[model samples]
Target chain A: MKIGILGSGNMGSSLGLLWAEQGHEVFFGGRTTEKGRAVAALAEQGTQGGTNDEAARFGDVLLYTIRGINPAEVLTSVEVLSGKIIIDCNNFEIPEGFAYAPIELSLAEKLASQVPNARVVKAFNTMAQEVFELAPSPLKDYQVSVFVCADDAQARQTVMKLAEDIGFTAVDCGELRHSRLVEGLGNFIRFMIIGQLQNPYTTLSIDVLPAASEQRLGGRQP
Target chain B: MKIGILGSGNMGSSLGLLWAEQGHEVFFGGRTTEKGRAVAALAEQGTQGGTNDEAARFGDVLLYTIRGINPAEVLTSVEVLSGKIIIDCNNFEIPEGFAYAPIELSLAEKLASQVPNARVVKAFNTMAQEVFELAPSPLKDYQVSVFVCADDAQARQTVMKLAEDIGFTAVDCGELRHSRLVEGLGNFIRFMIIGQLQNPYTTLSIDVLPAASEQRLGGRQP
Candidate 1:
């Protein structure tokens, strides 16, 4: 799969490396040429970095990792990603240092509206950037659960396979309405860090020992 | 020490029953006398259930389990609760449904404001009602972790002893502002259920084992 990543900051670059390492043709779409080339050069799997339009046109799967506030204008500006499986990882809250609620519109839902024909899925928004970059598998043999939300079944299935490729347990979270919860979980990670007086490292990832058939109802204690 | 519960709903009543069974004088309060008595009668600890005011006056330390939307209002209505050590367990998110970002006031801060003399420390917001009620702790052998947050040093230390009595692992989460993350983690639990199409019973418990001393500073491996 050819992966196109818009916004070559820490998150985009980190994930871009993962996809490229997973035998995917990864392309970088940075705000500047230097960043794009620099990220492209970091690839061991022939990852190439290009303009947003060029990267958008060159890939089968795209990741939207831009900041929350300006995603609409940025996506509109990137017009290259007209129709594709665009994974929405952008969150809406700004680091204004004040906690607000009733986040009127979600960045994912807003993107879906703008690109009606595109297959958009919401994920990775629930995890910390560092967690996304690190955090080992919760399940030893199987995969770590990743909550995925989208109206399109095919799109979700495709994304799930990608999650598996990247070593994850992809749990289908009903529809786009769930993106609200996913993003909420993401922001909550930040809150937990401050609460623990621990530097933001990522959420505490649990190692789930698989249950026997009788114990499979849910991950409850015996 | 006597235990006080500020709500007679499933969560509050459930914990009240457990504490009373453990031979503690438990006072559980609800909006109505009827609801409180119904739950308290089942406990058989001579547990008293009455108006919120009665619960506030009854307990040595108060456990607040009300909705976050109106923590200030709840405190205002129960004015006698001033100057007490409060177990603050609430999140201020709009209940209509999950919104990506909560566009409202921070309820904990509001709570701090309403009860100026009260010593507010956050705890019990992360557990499932079932875990708080039924998860047996073999006395520090396998106690669950619950983070505590507050500005006052004495209040935090006092709650630490109270938390041990309740069979939990209470980690002090810095100051009052840190309360947001402890409460925010609750949003992750809420969203995980909403996002993954799972129930509270099955999904809420994230069995976080004690982070090994070396692991805590080393890395967050869950």
Candidate 2:
């Protein structure tokens, strides 16, 4: 599978490297071409470096890592995003580094409106960069969960495959309208780990614990 | 400890019964005296039924289960809630039964302002009635977690002990302001279990799984 990573920051670089290691054709895109190339080079092979537009047009699936209120400015030049699986892992952040979008609609909803034809799936936004660096997310001997939400079922499934490829247990949360809940969950976990409980990065991973003897969608761990 | 439960609905009754069984003197307060008495009667002993004001003045710790915009209207008749630990398990709900305030401040925050003197601790609003009814909350051999948050550290600890008395692993999330995150988390879990994923009540319990070998506050399961 071809995966394009827009805004080659910590999330983009980390995810791009992982996907490249999994034998996917990964493209790292950013304004700083050298930085993008540097991230691509870390993958060893089967990865390319390019500008945002070039990466946008290169892949079957495009993963966005940009953060801000205005997504239109970022995707304005990207012409080939329509009819593509776009995984939105971006979230709006306040000064405190907790996720918050002042707008009535969520960032995912805003992005969907901006790119009308793109199959926008909200996934991986809830995870912290430090957790991604853990490789297989060694938490309680269970696969750490990555929740995906989108209107398009197929697009959600595709994003789930991508999440599973990264060794995450992908669970379908709901439609894009439910992105607010996902983002809020992210903030909740952040506050619990950093703000209140002061647990270290290695201490927490979102894993669903099913009731005894009950079957769930995601493979139950232990 | 004497526990006064305001709004003798399902939540108030279920929790009051549990506390009563745990040897705490419990009072069920409601508009309908018979209904409150009936709920209290289930516990057999160590429980009483009373009006809202009677319950308000009865206990050192008061737990509210009412859900409405105007908290003042309900607490106006009560003379002394000051210098008391108030357990706020109330969550604002929309027509869909999802937790939401649609206001600037959370229910716990608003309740704090209205009472002025009570130390408001938010806990148990996130758990479903089914889980509370479960004698031990049978979830993956681990006790289901109940998160608590409040400004007063002593009050928070008191509530955490209360939560433990009822067979839940009570986690201190943060200050009372973080109640918004708890409410959001309730909505997120509700959406996952009922709205989207459609997992049964018998299949879900809020559990935190930390990375292996990491020191965490609440007792690590497994």
| CAPRI category for model 1 | incorrect
Which ranges of candidate 2 are over 4 A from the true structure?
A69-76, A96-103, A137-140, A200-222, B69-72, B95-103, B135-140, B200-222
Model 2: per-residue Cα lDDT over B1-222, one tens digit each: 988888888888878887887789998988767877778877767689977667888889988888754446776554578888888887656436443433356789888887787888998876566555453434324455677989999999999998887767778877888787777666666666666655535222333445434534332222
List, residue by residue over B1-222, the lDDT tens digit for candidate 1. 676788777667766776676677988877777777777888656888887667888887778878654445554454676677877777655354554354344456677776787887777676556454333343233445566778888888877766666666667666777555555556656555443444443232222222333243333232
Q: Interface root mean square deviation for model 2, in Å?
A: 9.3
Q: Go through the candidates in order and give each one's DockQ.
A: 0.20, 0.26
Q: Model 1 segments beyond 4 Å from truth?
A: A31-34, A68-79, A92-102, A126-129, A132-145, A194-196, A204-222, B20-24, B29-54, B66-79, B88-101, B107-114, B126-128, B138-188, B191-196, B202-222
Over A1-222, each residue of candidate 2 has an lDDT whose tens digit, in order, gives 988888898889888887887789999988767777887887767689877766788889988888653445765454588788888887656436443433356778888887888899998876566655554434324456687889999999998988888677787876887787776766666666566555535122333445434534332222
What range of 10 consecutive residues in model 2 chain B has the weakest lDDT sum?
Answer: B213-222
Q: After superposition, how far is residue A84 of candidate 2 from its true place, in Å?
A: 1.3
